[model samples]
Target: MSNLSKLEFVALDISGKNFLPWTLDAQIHLTAKNLGETIIDDNETSLQDKAKAMIFLRHHLHEDLKREYLTIKDPLELWNNIQDRFDHQKLVLLLKARSEWIHLRLQDYKSVSEYNSALFRISSELKLCGDNITDEDMLEKTFSTFHPSNLILAQQYRERKFTKYSELISCLLVAEENNKLLLQNHQARPVGTNPLPETNAISTRSKHGRGRSGGPHRGRGRGRGRSNTWHRESHNTKIDGGRGSSRQNTGRPHKGRVSGDKDNICYRCGMSNHWSRTCRTPKHLVEAYQRTMKEKGKQTETNLIEGAPNSSSPAFWSDTHLEACDFIENVRDV
Candidate 1:
């Protein structure tokens, strides 16, 4: 009784719906147990082997079948009677398989795996019914069932002349994955956004007219070491009175003796008596100026004007002088 519970497959049902596969499982299990010959006519198997085969067969039978064949003690006779009773299943399965095969189309399934699985299942039934499906047949079936939009793609695959179905499926799966990745990237960062920079990933533009290395001409400095000295010397003479030094202000107007003087005007807003950093103008106006400076190729450091919040700057330029001469005339109105 303990061994009987170890039946390797489901018991045959009274309806015989699973008769074909149950027969196959029974044969293989019997062969593995060295009792295969007991089911053949006039076998010379020992009595012990015959008992083992009969017990195995009976254990796998439906309750109704067991009662009907209660008197049949011979394994060969029981096997033959069961085969004769359900043999018509082959004909029924073959007809259904043929219909499914006739209607099978790759385009009808959403993915290659699904279509391949269905094809293999149908082909398995056909082969069991003595109808073999070859590799060429599978490849042709797939090629003919591509969606109408993929006609050209199908033609290209056919041109590759793959002898095996697996090779074509591999290429198609790879292409599908790549296309998905491309779409994901496009959707992540849609069009008209800031384009990726091609060259010069480093932006030397400083937030406070200073470079990462803390040189005075940092933003305008170009070409390694000497540009720092040239920038400090050239720009300081105009803005810093040749002090060549950095000054930290408390956002206040710098004390000055003269008003209405040309040199005392703020370079940022074209106003008098205040440095660009300490000007009290609205932030939007300063941002507009920053944009204009960029449009005019002035390319100020990320700080743009002197008094904005400090943030990361953008790519620097080699030229030292600010190209604000023409635009400075219009700054007074702003």
Candidate 2:
């Protein structure tokens, strides 16, 4: 009886798994072709229309289903018989849809879009089953299912008294984007690592560049540097003798030091090869080095003194004292 060459929609299976949507598609297509009345009992549709409707219905049925209803010719009788066989699908689908709706929660998804898509899908199924979900219900469901940490945010959103779910979703999406942007900003610089002010930046770069470029040391004796260098050379000689020729061949001048270990460098003599704890430099020698730095700092402060009438002012003294203390603390931390 299936004389049509093309399928208008998904064919109804023998188990009637897609019975609901199949019936909907069948009705719409039949109506469009002027054969809709043939499927309604006592509608007085023409014989030609009935034959066309019957052929359309049979064409959209599984091969097994067509054989099962093989003897049915009248479209109305065929529609009623199919309905009687698959009508229980509505109640079954309704129960499944209700269960899914009850278990759905916004917090279960990582993003708002995913949760929104699931909400609409489940809501559509419920609608098809004669259960309509209102906008207020959707908003409440979303609000109630927020993660515990966002309870305050959820309350604030609720206080807005949004009447439509789309409006609430729009606000949530905007907030989500803002929060993501905030995290990116924080990660770009992070706390306690901000760039120094322009003056400080230039001063720091000049100081390090002078040391690396072997510029003449200011307000410091060359004797101390020569003594420190001799002590390190002698220590390396001792290590090479103690460890034997095999290890000596591969050992570096400062075995434990590398360029990346800047923080572990000696603060006393500005040596990058060793830490202050094991520095061979004498205590008084270290003290002299610190005093030299303090004098240099004071000389700079004298050139840039501000907020004070003269160097004798209490404000000037306070500023100098603070700078000295900061220098001491930096050395002590090493």
lDDT on C-alpha atoms for all candidate structures = 0.78, 0.78
Ten-residue stretch with the least lDDT total in model 1: 200-209
Residue 105, candidate 1: C-alpha displacement in angstroms = 0.3
Off by over 4 Å in 1: 1-3, 194-334
At residue 215, what lDDT does model 1 achieve?
47
Number of clashing pairs per prediction, in order: 0, 0
Evaluated against the true structure, the overall lDDT of model 1 is: 0.78
Model 2, span 117-229: residue lDDT tens: 99999898888889989998899899999999899999999999999999999999898889899999889864755553333111111111123223355356554332111
Predicted candidate 1 versus true structure: per-residue lDDT over 117-235, tens digit per residue: 89999998999888999989989999999999999999999999999988988898788789889999899865655544444222132123333544454444355333242333232
* Model 2 score (lDDT): 0.78
Steric clash pairs (candidate 1) = none
TM-score of 1: 0.57
